[model samples]
Target: MDTMRDRFAPVVSRILDEDPRVAVVLAEIGLVPFLEAQRRHPDRVINVGIREQLLVGAGAGLALAGMRPVLHTFASFLVERPFEQVKLDFGHQGLGGVLVSAGASYDVSGGGFTHMAPGDVALLDTLDGWSVQVPGHPDEAEVLLRQAIGAGDERVYVRLSVQANREALPVDGQHLLTVREGRRGVVVAVGPLLDQVLAATEGLDVSVLYATTVRPFDAAGLRRAVGASAADVVLVEPYLAGTSTGAANDALADVPHRVLGLGVGRRELRRYGSVDEHVAAHGLDAASLRERISGFLDVGVPGVPA
Candidate 1:
C-alpha cells in the first residue's frame, strides 16, 4: 500500500490539471515524484531549490496573485524553518494557501532530529484560522487535499505521513467519526495512529473517535461522545504529545472532564532508529498505548492486573 506522501504527487497533479488556479511550490525535498507535474505545468509547479523561506514566500506571492498555492516539503522545513515567512507572508498578510507536508513526526527518523517535525501541528496552532488536516490513509489525504484546495482561499495545512492505517475511513474534512461505541471513556485517535489506538483499546469499553481534520476540532462531536460515555478522554495524535489537549479541554470547558494527551514525547531520541522502533521508544505502540490508556481509564486488561 502506498503511503500518504506516495499518493500526494498524483493527487496534486490531477488538481493542477483540473484547476488552473492551483499552484505547487516546493523546496526540493520530494521533487522526483513531481518531476512530471513540473514538466507538464512549468509555470505552476515551481521548485525553489532548498530555500525553505523562499518556497513559502513564493507560495504566498502566488496566493496574493489570485492563485491557490500548494506548498510541499519535509514537515521540518515546511513549517518550522519557514515559520517566520509563514507568519508574515501568509498569516500577517491575511492571505491563504495550502501547506502540504511530508516526513511526519519521526517518519524519517534515520534522517535525525532535523528531518522530524513532531511539533508542526503545535506550532501551527499558535496562528489563527489555520485548518489542519492529518489524514490516516492515502485516500483520506487525497480527500483532504482536494478539500483544502477547493476551500476558497482559506489557510489549510495538509499533513502527510509515511505511517498509514490498514484501511481508510470516510472523512469529510470536518467532524469526527465515531469508530466504536462504549461507555467507559472516549479515545480520540488522530490520523495514522487510528489503527494503533484501535488495537490498543481492543476489548476495552471505550468509545473511539477518528479524526482526520483536527483543526476546527469537532467540539460538537466530542461533546456528543462524552455525553454518551465517561468524561475521561484520551487524545492519541501522531504528532507532538498534548498537541490537541487544549482543543479537547476547550471543547468540554463547560463540563468537568479529564483529558490525557498522547503522542511523540518532548525529549529527542539521540539514536537513529526505524519508525517502528521510534514508535515503541515514544510509548506509542499498541502494547504501550494499551497499558497507558487502560491505566488512565482505570480499566483492567484481560491478562494484566488491575
Candidate 2:
C-alpha cells in the first residue's frame, strides 16, 4: 500500500521529530508533504526554491553544521545540474547526506532530455563512497531508506522510479538476494528492474540476484551468486547502460566470466511518447531484455544450454 511518494513524507517527518540532526532540503518538488513538514519542523525542513545548486549547497552547509541533510529533487536537477556542488560540497568537504531522487533514468520520458538523467548514478559513482540504492518495490524502498538513514553521514543515493515490482522480496542485508535458481548463468537485478528482469528470464536457466543497494557493490556476494557455474553474469540495471560496468568487471576479476550489461539506451529520442514506448526503446522491457539476454546466454555463456 505504500507508494514511494507516500512513504517518503512519513519517513522525513519521523526523522525530523526523532533526530534533531536531520534536515530535509526541497527544490519545489513534493510541495504539499514538504510544506507540512516545514510547518511541523520549520527550521529543519528547508525549501530552497528552484535552485538545485543552492539546494545541494545548503545541504552541505547543514552537514558542516552538524546536521544530516536529505536533499530531494528530480535526478537531473539533483545530480546533473548541481554536480559541481555534489562533488565539491560533499566529496571535497568530506561531508555526507542522503540524496533521494525521483524520475530515475528515462522514467520521465514525456518530459524529454531536460528531465531524464540516466547518468546520475554514474556521476555520483565518480565522486566518493556514495551508497546507491535502486529499490524494486515501494515496500523495499521504505526498508532500504531506513537502513540508509541509520548510517549517519554516509552518502546515500536512493533512486526512485515509476515502475515497481510485484512484491517486496526478502531483503535483510545489502548483499544480493537470490529469488530464482538456474543452471546456466546468473542475472543480477538492480532496483525496480527486478520484476521485468524476472519476467524476461522466467523460462531460462539463470540464477536471479536482487539488489537494493548498488554502491558498495557487494563483490563477495556477487562471487557467491556466480558460485561454481560458468560465471556468466548479466547485470540488468535501471539507470544508464553500462553504468556499473567498471564495478562488475572489478567484482569478477579473479573468475573468468562473460557478462552482459543492460539499461537505458544511449541514443536520443526527440519525440515525446508514452513511458512504455521509451522503456521498449531502451531495451529495458521484458521482451527486449529477454531477446538480448537470451542471445547472450545462448552464444556467450560457455558450457551452458540455451
Best by lDDT: 1
| TM-score versus the correct structure, for each prediction | 0.97, 0.94
The CA lDDT at 298 in model 2 is 74
Weakest 10 consecutive residues, lDDT, candidate 2? 297-306
Candidate lDDT values, in order: 0.93, 0.84
Total residue pair clashes for candidate 2:
1
Q: Which residue pairs in candidate 1 have backbone atoms (N, alpha carbon, C) closer than 3 angstroms, thus clashing?
A: none
Residue 148 CA displacement from its true place in model 2, Å: 1.6
Model 2 lDDT on a 0 to 1 scale = 0.84
Residues 68-129 of candidate 2: C-alpha lDDT, one tens digit per residue: 89999989999999999999999999998999998887777788899989889888888877
